[model samples]
Every structure is written in structure tokens, then in C-alpha cells.
Target: MRFEIMNAGKIQLCASLCMWLGIVTWTGNMKLHIWSVFVQQSYEGDVVFSVLNEQVNVSKGLRDGKTFSIRSPVTRKNAIEHRVFWSAWLDSLSTRVFGVEHERAWRKQVRDARVVVLEAGCGRPTNRLATFSDGTRACVRYGIDADQVLGETLSYYLAELLGISNLPPLALSKLNLSSEQWASVRGHIEALEWSPNAIVSLTEFIPNVTGVFIPLHLRKQQGGLQLSPETVSNMTVTYLVELMQWSDLIIFDYLTANFDRIVSHIFSLQWDARVMERTTNNLLKTINGHLLFIDNEAGIVHGYRVLDLWERYHRLLLGSSCIFRRSTVRRISEMKRSGDSAKLLCELYRAREPLARELGSLSQEHALTLQNRIDVVYKHIQQCTDIM
Candidate 1:
């Protein structure tokens, strides 16, 4: 099965490249380079296209005036753990194909399990929790169309590739619910009856987690903690809020080209519901303070789709926001100095073959565009030396 999948993907990639080349010829300004890398005049100078043999080096220098203020929370222990997690994730991708095998086994195990809808999920998709025949429950995110399912599934693999541990294991599953069950929640779904059997994406459900939040000004007025504009600028306060997770998340968002994460949307908190209810502003203090990032389906489409140039880097990396932590900046800076930054990133992306093959609509061109964004991140990291 894997061999057939691999072969079919190669064929599709060849066909897509042929069509792309034809389009490029008609356009007369795009150049298809070696190593599946290409450039078009429309790209401006934002992306540098090169073959695999090409070496990219950005000089390290402190940019003027934007000094990072806070102490980094990415201690030696934390960095080691992150490194270990990344290594395990890469190995899983290369050998086990992580979610693929897990999903296969899980589906077979849950085949006889009863399914039930829990509630409407947070995003565009009508997501709900359903119980399996074995009395186990999983979060089911239905695809309005095949494309959305692909996006969600691909995002899960991409998150793993980036060493994001916040996400639970995900797999493709089919919901076997009665029509009446779906009808009860039909009003919440955009296309409840679009397809038969309702093909869905399943994620392992984590218990005891709640969305993080900032104290509302109104709440703060009633003796709640107030978050002044300068609060984020304060390094001590930022570090107290878990700077490592904050920085890692920002970098992850930049690489994935996801801009939906607003400052208002806080991180996920575990075991702190009581304290969270007390705080009206976006702040949380936990033992480890791990940030659980959900709804990653919004990424993997930055350069693939046509949008305004100004909207690029709509978040802090390219935007005017300076809310990122010093620890985050230091992590990237350390990588730049280590000289293994590009090599590590390239290895991490090497597992893209199986993932892209599964996502039928995601072409090699789109994959290359994602790499272009990663290249941009490499350049962006060079500016991080000035961070603190």
C-alpha cells in the first residue's frame, strides 16, 4: 500500500510539474529551476529559489534599537527536552509515519464503538466529540469538503514535523451516526448533509484543559488584574507568562504561515480553571506553562494562495508587534550560530513525501512555496540576535 501510494504521488507530482511548466511558459516570467525549486517575477525578491546544492547563509548582526527585554524561559533543561521531542518526532515521521499507523490501528479498534456528538467545535468546522464502540471518545472534525479534511489532516502532520507537542494524536475517521443525531446539530454545521457517512478527522481528546484568556477591562475594573499596554513590554511579566512557549509558538506560526492566532486568543491552560476564572486578562501561571495550540488547519496555505503582499507576515514576525519573548528570539539566534539550523530544518521537512502524497490537492509547487517560507524564517532569525 505504501509503495503504491509513493508511486502514485510521484506520478501526480510529475503531472503537476508539467502543467506548472506549461503555465510558466505561457506567463514568460517564471523560471523552473533544479531541485523542484522555481521562481517567478511576481515573487519579487521576497524568496530566493535555489537547487538543493545551494547554500544559504545570512550574516548575524544586531539590528538597531529593538532590544529584547525579558529573560528567556528556555533554560538548558527545556532546550534539551525540545531537542529530544524534535528528534523523536522526526524519527516517527521517517520510519513509523506517526499518525498514519496510529490512525489505522485506532480505526480498527474503534470500529464497533458507538459514536455520539458532544458539542459544536470552536472553528469553522462543525467539530464535536463522539464516543467509540469501545467506550472511548475522540474529537471529530467533519470535512465540509474533501479539501478541508486534507487541510486539517495535513496540518496535524505539519505540527508534528515542527515539534509541536500541544496537539493530541490525530487520524482520519468516519462518523457512523444516525441521520437524526446529525439533524440535532445540523443548524450548527455549514454542510451537515453535504456528504454521506460524514467523513471526519479524529483527534485524541485531552481532558482538563481550558482556553486561556486575558482579564476583560470590565473585570479588571472590579479588582481583576489589569493588563496595561506596557504589560507585554515588561520582560519579567512576560517571562512569568511562559516565554518559551510563547516564542516557540510565534516561530511555529511564522513557519506555517498561520495568522489566525491573535493576541486576544490566549493559550490553553490545564488545571488552572479556578485561577483562570479570576483573571480577566490574558495571563496564566502553571507549573510548566505549556501552551496547547489548536486549530492549526489555517496554515500551509501562505504562498500557495493569492493574497495581498501587505498581508504577508500579518503577525509579529513581519508586523509591528513586538510582543514575542527574548527566549524565543534567543532560541533562533542560537540555531543560527550553531550552523546546523538549515540542516535540521531540511531533515525535519524530509518526511513531507508521505504527507503531501496523502493530501492530493497539495502540489509539489505548494510544498516548495512552504519551503520558501522556511527560507524566509532563516533570514528572519538573523535579526533575532538583537533580541536581548
Candidate 2:
């Protein structure tokens, strides 16, 4: 029995020691500066983000009536890469990736993307964003741009893309209240407390919104709007500030020919080994003691090592055992078409989401949420069971 247990620990240790700080090292030809060398092989437990308290707010100096702080855990400095001239290039790539019949293909893709987006735009080639986001099964999209969409044909495309009938509530229910959903919710929430979005690993999320989103200020430059990419990006920030409140993050097109706006953030994604090493060195000074090193970037959380010491401390202190937690995926299996009615599905989802929150949280409000979730789930179960 002891041998079996020890063997299990060794296996767990192996997974935790895998290469995580890595980009898809498919081949040297596709290599884009191999800087994400600190990859984690696997991570134990859910690499989570628990707010210490809702009352505690970091006063990171306010700018323009808004303040910023690193609300999630820091996984900075995995070797980053950039692709310049990406707008035009991405258009072709997306066309190939998503296929010409974008409606059918893209709709299906969104049901499985890391982030889903519903955008309204005509100027920017929409599918570039769509194709890139489609690689993951954790996304859905809806677009109302008259030109970009092909009418009810497009509406149907959106309906299918979101994986539901043409109903707002049904589609809305599919959203996991994560970052992508919060973008939509922020548009509605008046008070605008912390974005009620769930935690996410270091996966880069960039939503697709259309409208040329360029600057009217640069409409009639004497040089025929020959602006640098960086300037263009700066302009986009100003434009975004008007159109959407503030996204958790923004991703710019990797326009290679135009190198103006592809700044440090872009450079980070572009995979600079030197920069990555420097960033890793700095983190060692900060969080290395708490989090053990794990696979770097190939899977979920990007930078930061999986701190085993802290994991052991918490597991013992909290008396919770990690079961298949090191797999490093925040996945939701697609609802099987078991002839289950959409209404029931929505109800079931609504009932359990609060329970998920209650289970996932580890804050001071845990007790209050626990009671509320119990009440909500109990009532929901009772209703369905009584009907049955």
C-alpha cells in the first residue's frame, strides 16, 4: 500500500515537472522565438484565483477615474512572440481556417472556444478574429453588423454558432459568466463593481468587435492616414474607451509590415527568450517560494511555476485532496443532445452556477454564498423533482 502511494506521488511529481513554459514547438519552421522555456509539465489542484476579500481594493493609483491592479495571479514573462502585419495576413489564414462557409463552421467553433464574441463591425475582416478564436472550443459569437452578416442567414449562423435556438435567454445561459461574458455584462451593469467574471488561466482572450473601430481624428491625415501601428493601437484604445467600458484585456492584430503599435505587450506574446529569462528571474524573487515550478505555457496558466510547497501546505491545512486537478483544463463538456428540452437545460444550468460559485470560492463571503447556493439549488431541485 505504501509502495502504491509512493508511486502515485512520483507520477504526480512527473506531471508537475513537465515543460509548461513553451509555445507549441511543432517544428523549427513554425518557430517564433522560443522564449516560453519555463513551461509547467502539469499543475496540481485547480490553479485558482481567490479574492482575499471584496472589501480589499488595491489603490494602484487612479487614472482617468479608473484604477488598475493585478486582480489575478501573476504569470508574467513566459517567452512571448509577435506577428507583425497580422491584419491582412490573418484574413487569409482565417479564410482557410474557418472555410468560406463561415456561418456554419464558425457557429460550431464558438461553442468550443476559450472565449466567445458577438461583434458588430464591417471594416475589419471579421473572420480573422473568428478563425483565431475558433482553435479552442470555449467560444460563442453573435454579430449584428448588417454588412458583415448575411441577414437571417447570418442570424441563423449566429444562433447555430452559439449552439442554441434563436433565443436570447438560451444563448445567454450558455455564457459561463467568465471574462468574455463579463464584457457583455459590463455593458448592462450600472454600478460596475468588480467584473463578476470567473477566474481564467493565462490564456489570452481578445474579442472581435467590428466598426472599422479606427479613429475619426486620423480620417484626413495629409499623408493619407499612413499611421504607425503603435499609433493605430493607441488610437484603438481611445476608440475602445468610448465603445466598450474597459475590457479585462485587449489584443491587437499582429501586423508585421506595420510595427508601430506592437509594443511590449505584443513583444511578450512574440516569445523573446532574453525578456522571458529576465521576467522569470524577477518572479523568483517574488512568488517562487509560494508556488512550485510547473509546466510553463503549453497548457493553461502561462508564466509562474506550480509551487508544490504551498500546495502541500494548503492541502494539509484545508483537508482537500486534488482529484484529476492537475490536468490543467477548465472544460465544460457540450450538452449531449439527449432529447433534453432547452428550458430544462437552462434551468439546470442556472440552478447549478450559484452552487459552482459557492464551491469555487474561498473568501470571507464563502459562508453567505454557501447558504444562498444551498437555498437556490434546493428549490430548483424540488421544482423539477415534483414535476417529474
Candidate 3:
């Protein structure tokens, strides 16, 4: 229940609450500055954005079709430290300091917001620019498949269930789009919609992010560029090594049988060295690179199609070797040894039980399936741990 708020070039990183005029909190892992806790109502339930009652000009973050470049240099020392920091954070997830309860509260605060659709991007599932009612802007994806969206939601729950940070806060809400907005998205849609309100999943977009250094499979999909595994690994290891998130993400994908995670979907945040120097923030200054997982709508399909898809991508997870850190395995081992793994699973089951009643049919069945898969995943973890 703690957040470090940055304002007017000053940062306060403590758990204690203080009263300040027009305060806004950083809403994502990027730690980029944005609006804080101002509540309002929209067509959706509750919209919380940063600007409260004041008018401020905040950048919507590269919406003008500019190419974001990754110019920040990554050294060996920084990469190792980044790996260590992230792995340690993953290990801390199941503890009292960062458990499911905290995850729920934090997620709710970040996910519920009223957003306006900006520019729409290409793909089967589309990307859009959206601004919160409080004027904080982000990129979003509308859920094309109800089952997939439910699975994505459950994945967040699973991340909470495992006490790890996977995807950023994904808000499930209705959005108001103008006629222009409707026209912009018409090519991507299957049916007609005169109605201005549409239910969408809004993922908190990170500002100043450059495209990630994708894996070979993703590169092939993009344009069929082939590079040796060593060359690719060497390039990626400059900015990422021992990526604990990859381990957890792959485990999640396996549990859900998701296969859409191509390398191009990962994002890398940009660091302004000049800004870092001015702020004198040690954390930001020391580790200038971070990776994020996005586009999680391909999981938990309702039919046999997922089986075909899973077969295609399962090797990425259970591969003989990759850049993923074995931190997830170690964490699982620690949890089982401390008698918390089973307890944690019970907590997840209880948390998901009501959803089984609320969502009904496919989701309800999938909820039960999810719990069963948790058992399978535990066994998988045991196998990995034994080998390790």
C-alpha cells in the first residue's frame, strides 16, 4: 500500500501519507510521472486520473507517429544488477511484504479509470490511444475474445496468486469513442457499432518506451530475419540477462496454454540520462533499462484451436536453453519448503471461486480448469526444481 509520488522534480518514496495540493502518483512500473488520486464518474463506473480539478498540459507520449529509438547504452554491470534486482523482487512476491491482497488493492486502484480513445493501431486485436478522465493518457487494447479477456484477467489473478508482477494493470471498462474514433477502428472490426460506448481492456501504456529486441521467432514473423541463437542472445543480454519475468511469463503461458507471445510484443523503456542526472535518483540512474510484457489476449481459448497454438510455442518455455533466469524455479522451491506454495494455491482457488459463479459457462468451467492447471503447474515446478 505504498507508492512514491514525484512532483515538480521532487520525489517522495515513503509509506507515510501526506497532504499536498493537486497530487498525482506514478501509475505504472515505468515510474514515469503522472497524475495521482482524483476520483470522478464517467459512463464507466469510477474514473480516477491525475489532474483532479486543475488544467495541466501533459504529453500523451509519442502519439504523433514518431519512431522511438533505443539509444541508451547498456553495460555488463548494469545488466547483472538489473537481473539481480528483478529476481530479488520476484522472490519477494509470495511473502507478507508483497502478497495477493496487496496485489488486488494495487491493481484495483490502477485499473479502474475512464478513458478516451486516441489513435488506433493495426493488428487482429487493435491498439488505441486513450486518455484518462483526469487527463493521464495511455495505450489500450480492446478484448476481441471474451474467453481470452477472461483468461488475461485470470492471468493477472494468477500473477497475484503467485505474488509476482507480470503484466501492468489492465483495466476492464467501457470506452466512449467519437464518430472519428469509430471510423478509425472500422477496418479492424467485424461488425457495425453506432453506439459510442464499447467495453475494452485498457492496459496502462508506458511513456517513452522503445520496441524490444525480439526473439528469432518474432523476427521471422516480422520479416524473416534469421540470426544465430548466440548472436541474438549476445545482443539481448546487453540489456537483459537472467530475466525472471520471462520465467514466470512462460510458466503462465504454459498453464494457460497460450502461444501468441512473439518476441515483438515485449517493450523496452527509454531512459533519459540527462533527466536522471538532474533527478539524482539512484534506482533510475543505476538501472537504466527495463522490459515489459504486453498483448496477453491470446491465452485460454475456448476451443481446440489453443491446442494447435500451444504446440507451436511450447518449445519457447521448455526449451533446452534460453536467456530466462531460473529464479522462478528457486522461488517455487523456497515456497514449497516453507509450506507456502499449497497455501498460496488454496488462496487463489478461493479468490477465483466467486468468478466461477459470476461469469458462468465458459469462464466458470475455465475457472475450475485453472485450478486444475495450478496442480499441473506445481508438478511442473517440482520437475524443474529437481533438475535444477
Which candidate tops lDDT? 1
Tens digit of per-residue lDDT, candidate 3, span 101-128: 5446544644554444355542333556
| Model 2 misplacement above 4 A | 1-219, 223-388
The model with the greater lDDT, 1 or 3, is 1
* Per-candidate total of colliding backbone pairs: 12, 52, 5
lDDT leaderboard ranking = 1, 3, 2
Per-residue lDDT tens digits for candidate 1, residues 1-388, read: 0111123234533332333223211222222222323321122323222222212221111111111222322222212222212212112211111245564576455444445445554445466766554567777766555566665666555555555555556655443344543444444344455455555666665555555553332123132222232332333323433433444555666655554453222222234434435432322222223345665555555423532431343333332222333434445445555544434443433343233333354556556655665555556544432331
Candidate 3: C-alpha lDDT: 0.40
In model 3, the worst 10-residue window by lDDT is 279-288
Error of 1 at 19 (Å): 58
TM-score ranking from best candidate downward: 3, 1, 2
- After superposition, the stretches of candidate 3 with alpha carbons farther than 4 Å from their true spots are 1-117, 122-125, 175-198, 214-242, 263-288, 302-305, 321-365, 368-372, 385-388
- Position 79, candidate 1: lDDT: 22
For 1-388, candidate 2 gives per-residue lDDT tens digits of 0111122234422222121111111111111111111112124422222222222111211121122222231211111012111232111111111123442443343334443333332122221122234353221222222111111121222222223221111112132444453344444322322224322211112233121222242222133222233343333222322211101001100100111111232235346534323322101111111111111111111000122222232222111111111000011012122222233323443352332232231222322322332243234323423432
TM-score (C-alpha, index-matched) for candidate 1: 0.48
Candidate 3's clash total is 5
TM-score of each: 0.48, 0.15, 0.49
* lDDT of candidate 1 at residue 189, scale 0 to 100: 48
Looking at model 3, residue 168 earns an lDDT score of: 58
